[model samples]
Target: MEQPWDYLRHNDPAAAGILDALANDRTLEDIDRARILTAVDHAAHDLEIRQRLTAELTTLGSAAALHPSGLRTLPGTRFATHNMLAGQVRLGRVVPTANSALMRAGDFGIDHDVLRTSLMVIGPPGSGKTRSLAIPIVEHLALASLAGKASLVVIDPKGTDFAYDDWFDITIDPLNPTHGFSLFGGATNADTAADRLTAALLPPNVSDDKAYFKDASYNALYDCLAPYHAAYGAWPTVKELLALLRASQSVHDQVKAALKGTPGAKEWKEHLDNRVRQSQGSHDPAASLVERLARLDRPALRKIFDHQHRFEMRDINRPVRVRVAIPEADYPEASRVLARLVVSQFVQTASAPDTNRRIFKGLVIDEAGRYVDDYVARGVQKVRSNNAGIVLLTQTLADFPPDVRPTIFGSTGCKAVFGGVDPETADHFSRWFGDEWITQNTVSRGQTSSITYDDRTIFTRRSGHSEGHTQSVSSRRVERARWTPSDIITAVPPGHALMALATSDGNRVGPMLVNLRN
Candidate 1:
């Protein structure tokens, strides 16, 4: 007949204090409550005390509930509300139960701080991977931006997925010169510009032979840009860079004669001579590099990067939404180049020393596999402390090359896998979520016959026979994955996904189902 709080007060006064705090404080944040509950859970060794604490905690919010495995449970709406109230950016809601036919409010959600380590959302086309996950998160971030709590930068390579034109303050279209945005605005020196340009031109995995040529091309490009920086004190336009790459002798002589006493003029002249000599050879080391850079010579790309627009790295510190829309189908080659440029620029901006960690800055790349490289992966690893987050949406794990896939996967702290994923990718998630003990039931059947003659009866009457059957059933625990690879393929429905989130305490909460809020 005694109350749970009374028992806590009599036995464990510390847990009783936590309960008293929860009951008295009307404005206690969910995060603080979670921290208090975690402390209580650790302090209470007795099973009854823990159960009482969990019961009391659940009344605070759905997120207060704990899984049987002792991990805290967060429902979707609660997760979103917790983050929004706490000023953290929302990713999506979490559905605690898996393979459910219906969804409800108060589901768990992922936040920006959790995603500062990076996030990977994998599902096939038409599987609601974008609609249910990426878009929703982007919308939430945009809302946060509107409230002056955060900023957003979305790289839409396909250009069709993001429909919130009204939400973004700056919309950059590489195909439209009128909406121009500079990729080199963040480059402080010639060397940084060269590195950014090199990453934009080269893919993630370049052949050994191509790597040598890339280095040569980088040096040539650096020299060409060094003069422009010395004279103008700013990065050169795409048109200027292209002109230098394909410069004639007279133009070269003019640039050299004009900058004879510059700091890097001597080195630049030597590199230029080497490039000129190499150009005459049958096997030009910079031939492939030249061809890749030539893609930027198109009227659309040339105009886009010709002049710097208003969007810059410092804009992330303010409340702004920068949407980069590149249509891949219309300009396949140019799209790849532009996508790489935008992501690389973000990495450079995030890496700068003056970046503001107090404001939340996010970069969302839909169909990221088309553009992700080692630079982006390394950025993901380093951006956590800078108060920046990245969300990469890809159709499949196979979209990333073999060598860089592990780096991308390893850098990500959370992963949401939706339906229609292949067996191999599903198996990867299964292993990532790890194993659990499952109850296995075994049943056996047998038949037995016994013939007993009445001892008092004579031998002539001892012809009676009887037949009997027996059945036995038993249950035991076996270790197995909570969700098998096939379970993902067959059980997960559209608009639903299995999310495995890494908690702040370094615990993985769920590979549980999450219902996307429409």
Candidate 2:
């Protein structure tokens, strides 16, 4: 019935023929004006369609759908079953794309390549940022599991986001309530525990001012490591890491003295006791400690067992990435530190001769705006080229320190912004992308002189554009670009987003609505 696709194959002779073909179909005349206008608007505005048409279509070649392979790498959220059209957009289903999958309701054929530039989904609390990101984490891990690869490293601030309890043949471990000969103490047999402790205690953020953390706080470091040793039952499991820390802490007494302090010693002892109490409520201190450590370390311990490789040993099949989620309440600083450490260490580990093959490790830090703003900015600026991607999530502009927003956006290769009603955040973001679009119009009326005046309908002149997030990157810089009055009024519920890609050839790909979950 003279559809958009039909225009490709007809211009003059064929156009008349197509018209004739549709002439017999009376129903074809009933097509809605609104739908036809929408199509025309899309053809005019959507950059992806424009590029494809320019590149592939000639006088002879038309009517064919644009292939998805042409999509250049851009950060986005993907759904399992592509939601090509609206599916009862509900608050519960509305969320951001957590990891790196971008899906639209219909089949646009955008290539689902392994994401390069990491994603940062910013919104606000209850904006569904975490859940949106978590789905991708679980799905990506599942894909890795299927491929017989370990591809995810989750450093959860809450520790319960992605439950791998029975899913991956992996273990879940929390560092807490452990006691006895500490790894931070440098006991020869406790060397392994010391190493694990070192790995655990290595702060994610390191400054020149606090560079001597290794030597300045040995006992505090030990207390931090205590949770790990307690979790593993012995320090030997992480011996090599201990050796590295030993070198760093060679002259440190802060750790030793801190451990020896009366209160410190008592707290340490009681922590050990709590481990035991967690198990079966034991009377014996050591026994109680053992049980408690078991409970806390069980997950991490189980993960170790599943790998079929010792901590210090190497395995070709071992997953290079691992995600650790610890509640902010348990060890807030540690969560951020662990995130930083893991990224830095993985990059370092990838270059090390023996571990170099395990080079492609990544870390996804959710709600990062609350904790590691500066580190995230620096990490995004430097890490991607090293084959290490860091995906950070935050729900609001206020959630992050205000001063770093420009740097954060500048350093990030991929930027994703979800829903926020706040004009401060949304409007600030608009400057980068464009603006939160609002339609404004002035309709003139014709008047007739009667007893009063008769109202006459004049045309409504439309002005302004739609608002959505857009990403721009060149050889020299990166920024979040927005579009003003980008398009018409399209109602997008949660879990949905309009994305735009600025590729090399002066083409702006979209501001397409993409769905990440179902």
Candidate 3:
């Protein structure tokens, strides 16, 4: 009770664990042992949980469970929701393959440390990516959240995959009417909220040839949002923002009158002038972004956008777990918009100065391809250092633009490839896995012909012909992909995946096979 070791010494099972530790001839340093003890003690005051921690600490040392996963345990099968006490979750064990050695058939576990580096899992449908990887990790994080160590947000496009209602404090389902997400994702800064929404609402190619249009769209939204927030102290309603985006004459008149001689009034008037000027052209640059927003303003979604009670991204660092289920089937484009908005808002809020450093934050997007724009890809590297991590699940590498693929892949330190991935995607993984040196054998064979007239030289025409055969074996060093495209595409078992992991401190493993079945 007073001292953890003293408590452990009195526990017969835990005492047996100590004896086992002594038998191993290895031990953790005093500081590490103390840290583990303190984490365990703080996470649970239950006598039984403490005894469990004592046994685990004595047996596994530094790798022991840090604490109980949650206040209570739950049953699990294809997806596991237990054994997260160590601040880590076991994914699967490494497997040996024809092209690689099993350095160790160790289990792949991810905790806040590994997650701080972010993870990108790419595989086709029915590849066990969702069941084996996402579900386990999300389940672990949720349990960790209940232990008061993490905050989690799961964006479920299908609206059912991550529906553990009891585990999540917030279930954002628009169809339910009782739950929703903030229109601006609870952004504190007006311009930041404007920018995030602008990024999401615009087309993917807005930042391509006509980059000015992207800038204009951002500026256009900011002009209306800043003054409105300065006046009303809140984000504008979806209808109000829509009217502003369309540059309607009546809305501008009402806004101009409302802000006459107010702060930023002159700038607001100038932006209105430019908006009117832009609207006069045969083609308005803001048309594309407006079209996207109109999709959200429809009867199917406007209420949720304007929902009074909703979860905000700014509150994610408060030991909360939220599951946002988007109705992608009925509103495909709107769902993507919502997903993109969540990504943008998360990046902004998590990177802010006031974000809680002690609470680990995680975002798991079941199908993240459509939501990943240039902004999201670039922001991945920024948030990892801020105690936030994201798990991106994609069906194919082709979902990302060719130019941004490297940025996305490079930013995420942890990567996984499931069985049956396309050759091109496998090739990408193959190249990323790099090359290793191995001994290659070469067998050489040759035939020789010769003529002799030795013994019967005097007999003028006496001659002989001889033929000889020779063989030799030689070995040389050569470099080959650790996991070639062919091997990556074919060798991975049906219920396994290829994984590579890197911790926050630069520790890395894999380009190895992992058996997911077990």
Q: Estimate each model's TM-score.
A: 0.74, 0.45, 0.78
List the global CA lDDT of all models: 0.69, 0.40, 0.75
Compared with the true structure, what per-residue lDDT tens digits does model 3 show for residues 141-232? 77677655778998998888887646677787767656667878787777778777887777655446699888877777776777666656
lDDT for 105 (candidate 2): 39
Instruction: Mark the 10 consecutive residues where model 1 has the least summed lDDT.
Output: 451-460
User: Candidate 2: where is the Cα deviation over 4 Å?
Assistant: 1-105, 108-114, 148-150, 166-172, 175-321, 333-336, 347-360, 370-376, 435-492, 500-509
Model 2, 44-79: lDDT tens digits are: 556675444434333313222221222111124433
**lDDT (tens digit, per residue) of candidate 1 on 406-517:** 8899988889998889998998888887877645554444442222222121122222443455655556676767778998887887787888777434666666686665
lDDT of 2 at 120: 58
- Global CA lDDT computed for model 1: 0.69
Q: Give the distance in Å from residue 223's predicted Cα in candidate 1 to where it truly belongs.
A: 1.3
Separately for all candidates shown, the number of backbone clashes (residues 3 or more apart, or on different chains) is 9, 51, 3
- Of 2 and 3, the candidate ahead on TM-score is 3
Question: Candidate 2, overall lDDT?
Answer: 0.40
